[model samples]
Target: MSDLSKRRLKLWIRLLGVTRGAENHLRDYLRREHATTLPRFDVMAALWRRRDGVTMSELSRMLLVSNGNATAVVDRLEADGLARREAEDGDRRRIRVRLTPAGLTSFEAMATGHEAEVDAIFDRLSDNDLDTMREILTRAGKAT
Candidate 1:
């Protein structure tokens, strides 16, 4: 095998291992807190970061989920009063989803502790290594 092929294979293994470790920690913590799954948290996080509400279609694209998947998730969030769907007067069919004030507060509380724990999970990484990892991962995401 070529040297580059071996290097790429190692990178893939490392990526999967690191991701699984972090995900498992997070999943366990969130479950203990309130039985929140990662997918639900991800949907809330996407809305949390966006100042202006995102359209349902746009959210599906951002989350790399199918439109039906996004719709089902949104339905649950709406039923829980965490999110609200607004119809545009200009286009009645277009539905934009926004987090309620309650949702914002909930996400903030959860995110604070979540960030601290996740940060410590990678505390061993040097600043330079962290930066490089973020850059590489960001590029990889764009490629996908």
Candidate 2:
């Protein structure tokens, strides 16, 4: 293979490895410290961003997941009193979901800890390292 092609492949592998390792560490941290699954946390995070709430279809699209998957997670959230679903006034079939007050509080707590955990995980990287990586990733994203 050409040198350029070999370098490209190696870079891709390294990127994938880093992404997976970070995700796995986050999953373990959330589970052990918060007693929450990543998916559940994700659902709550999405809802917390929109105080007014979002339609089921909108939520599914935002999360890039299937309707069934979003519904299942929301169902669990609702059962736990972390989320509430309200039927549309004109169309009962359509429903909007929002986080409860308790959910907001819980997510705020989780977010604070999550940020700390992530910072600790990458604490070895210097400010210059982070800035350089961010610029490189931004360029790569724009290219795609």
Candidate 3:
């Protein structure tokens, strides 16, 4: 096989394994250090980055979770007092989601801790390799 052909048929399982490893690493860190699940943190992470609170549909799209799944996650966060939902005064049907002050504090702490773990994971790469990897992955994400 030509070099390109070999890459074209490369074992997807290996790629999945690598992806799973990264997921597991983050999940483990979130569980042990933050006492939270990856899904919950992901929801908070999305909201934390938003200058203003986002609508449920926006959160669903940004997080790549189903509307139902996102709703469930939001419900859990609300129950735990980590998130608050406000109905748009003009449009009663539309709701906005934002992290509570407590939630923001929690998200910030988790972010700092998570950054360290992510940096540690990438520390093995040379600077050039890391930059290239970042560029490639960002393009890959946009393609998605």
Candidate 4:
């Protein structure tokens, strides 16, 4: 293989490794500190972004997950009083889900800790390093 092809393959592997490591660390932090799984946090985060609420189909699409998966998470959230589902005004078959007041409070606390944990994870990276990495990754993502 050409030098360029070899380097690209290595870069891909390194990128995957970094991504997985960061994800694993975040998972552990969330589980240990908040007793929540990544999926549950992700679902709450999505709902937190949309105050008006979202349909199950929309939520599934947003999370890039299957309907069943989204439904399962939502089920747990609802059971925990973190979320609620209401019948769509014009469509009885459709439902819109939103975070409850308790959910909002819980997610706010979680989000604050989540941000801190992420920051600590990359505390060694200087501001310039972050800027350069962000630019490189943005360009690479655009290529795909």
- The best candidate by TM-score is 4
In candidate 2, what are the lDDT values of residues 19-121, reduced to their tens digit?
8998899999999999998888888989999989999899989899999999999999999999999987768788899999999999999999999988988
**Which residue pairs collide, candidate 3?**
none
Q: What is the TM-score of each predicted model, taking all chains together? A: 0.87, 0.93, 0.88, 0.96
RMSD of candidate 1 to the truth, in angstroms, is: 2.2
Query: How close to the true structure is residue 27 of candidate 3, measured as C-alpha lDDT?
Result: 99
- Winner on lDDT (2 vs 4): 4
All models, RMSD in angstroms:
2.2, 1.3, 2.2, 1.0
* TM-score of model 4 vs. true structure: 0.96
Question: In every candidate, how many clashes are there?
Answer: 0, 0, 0, 0
State candidate 3's TM-score: 0.88
RMSD of 2: 1.3
lDDT of 1 by residue, 1-144 (tens): 999999989999998998999999998888888568788888889999985789999999999999898888889889999999998666878978989998898888889878987998999999999899899889989977
lDDT values for all models: 0.88, 0.92, 0.90, 0.96
**Worst ten-residue run, lDDT, model 1?**
30-39
Better of 3 and 4 by TM-score: 4
TM-score of 1: 0.87
lDDT of model 4 at residue 59?
100
